[model samples]
Target: MSSEVGTEALTRRGLMLVLSSPSGAGKTTISRALLKEEDNLVMSVSATTRPRRPGEEDGKDYFFVEPVDFNLMINRDELLEHAKVFNHYYGTPRAPVETALSEGRDILFDIDWQGTQQLAQKAGDDLVSIFILPPSTAALEKRLKTRAQDSAEVIAQRMSKASEEISHWREYDYVVVNEDVDHCLAEVKAILKAERLRTRRRAGLIDFVNRLREGY
Candidate 1:
């Protein structure tokens, strides 16, 4: 045998599967489910200027960097995309993503609309963005409250920001209403299955088809 390879059985370029949603919209939940069930899919670890929380590793949770270092990365164009949020900076490094694509291993990005837009501009064809929307406004608020991870003030802030986030739904390649987690996850998986078949992503597809034609 040559070597142990990725779970993908085909010779194809990997894609960036970006799932964006407002707080408590089930995007994170669906992303976890997808990673658990799907083969050859890996999470995209981002670099941030924010301080790491308890139990979060340096490289695992995020590549924690100083603001100056993050600025250097931006200046060097080492980052595929960078954005400032809530007085902190976050960005995706370009090198690992390119390597993963060449190796035919898909990457899952749990990002926001800002990052998704930058990724689209940087690597349009490689990106498949999906925006998750809640069933209704009231339902979204209820979910936020049920999670109980934030204070009343923070929940209110998220709810307010959610309206803005939801407005960018039209920018995504696909949109899924996340009323039901299982059903929504199924739809997202279906989308991934179909996107994997895109002609451009199949690296040797043209030559393979030609070879088949010659044999016939």
Candidate 2:
């Protein structure tokens, strides 16, 4: 006889959404859009030994630290995943990510395949990995050139490395061919929505269902 509809209470465990692609691909653009639109998600800030560039703020862009400190963190097992890239060490701190997951706040990671592999190994169930690919090889080249930030030699280096990056496409949970930015964004968003709905991710669902059946 109750007119009101019953709503079950549930709490979802946060997921680590990883978006990786070759340099010229549109993962960065897609990541920016996702962060802007997704309210419950935050970018996973990484600590790096690389020098802070102009307009880069410590703890904002990256937690810039000395090489010695980075090594110390590695030795202490404080980093969830760490890698040496171009002679600079980059890593994600474990404490903050654990806190976020406990609070049910999703974290977005923009990292390479190696870092993704490390995270997958550490937190397989909590992670959703997506790999973005350009529409074509020529398109990838065009995008790198259009940026005009890197020199020709650098562009060539990136192009050469892209093949190896793309080869890891099979490793991801989802693959988006980034021919259209809007379409790709929508696809990734859809994947996130579906992943969030997974029964394993939503805690208290079983209890809520039992309460409903008992007329509570």
Candidate 3:
């Protein structure tokens, strides 16, 4: 088993990993940790019409564009998926994602359920979707307040929307309840590893098996 595993050439088509969660459920935290630890995995830089934040770099954190330009991209069918949130448009550009997949470099999308649905419609076989759930409603509310980044009114608004966000949980390929950050990260990592090893993803395996049967 060890020898066979070691000798097999690993050649796989990259996957689109979509992680969705309510506002405070730790999807961002898990995404950051995964990118840090996994060499071939990178975050999917989205294009948006929203103004860039103070520290965000163009084409890195996000591609900030005008609303008119965003509409043009949609018209051209250049985006894999797009949605409007808080009156701003955000989308995953198609070209970059296709290039990365051909090179076997996995892209992680930190998007909501609506975006995930669009991606599924466009790239069903290549996508692996996960929905993260909080351990409890009280815990979720506590997390939102603990962040201290939002005003009380905004936090209340998020709490109200969280249930609606979580209602799409049935659409995901996997679901993780984030009771502990480290544990949740580990579970997601495990899922990535297992998915990477799937027979269909590993394209080189067919040739390796053929060679073995021919006694070469």
Candidate 4:
């Protein structure tokens, strides 16, 4: 068993993990924690027409672009998925994702329900989407208020949108309740580990196993 396990570890592919949540959920925090803990994971930077937020650096938080340029990308079929939220356009570009896949690097997406739908259409087999939910509506609202980043009116609006977003939880392959950040991060990490070991992702495994059986 030990020798077989060692051989299996030598043949595995990386994961394409998508983590999504509503406005005040802890998806971003969990994603960042997972990235910090795992060397093989890379955040898939998204392109958007929205202005950069305070403390956000270009190409780090998002790839900010003009509306016209964003539309050009849409027309060229260059985006894997895109959507308009609060009058701003956000999208996942196709090139970088493919590059990461080819390089055997795990790509993480911090997107919304609509973007996840588009990603499923574009990378159905390779994608493993997980939706994170706050433990309760009260807890979610509390989180929003605690952040203090948005006004009361805005927080109310987000809470409303969160209801609609939560409706799409069943669309994801995995669902996680984020009551604790550390525990949720561990759940996501376990999912990524399992996804990486999936047989479909290890396309060369059969040939390798055959070689092993042949005593070469």
Q: Which candidate should be chosen as best, given lDDT against the real structure?
A: 3
Off by over 4 Å in 2: 1-8
Clashing pairs in 3: none
- Model 4, range 2-87, lDDT digits (tens) per residue? 22434554555555788889878887789878989999999888899998889998888889999999999999999999998889
Clashes of each: 0, 0, 0, 0
Compose the digit string of candidate 2's lDDT tens values, residues 172-203: 99999999999999999999999988888877
lDDT per residue as tens, model 3, 109-128: 98888899999999878899
Better of 3 and 4 by lDDT: 3
Residue pairs whose backbone atoms clash in candidate 1: none
lDDT of each: 0.90, 0.89, 0.90, 0.86
Off by over 4 Å in 4: 1-13, 51-60
TM-score of 4: 0.86
Query: Could you tell me the TM-score of candidate 1?
Result: 0.90
lDDT value for candidate 1? 0.90
TM-score of each: 0.90, 0.91, 0.91, 0.86
Which 10-residue window in model 3 sums to the lowest lDDT?
A: 1-10
Ten-residue segment with the worst summed lDDT in candidate 1? Answer: 1-10
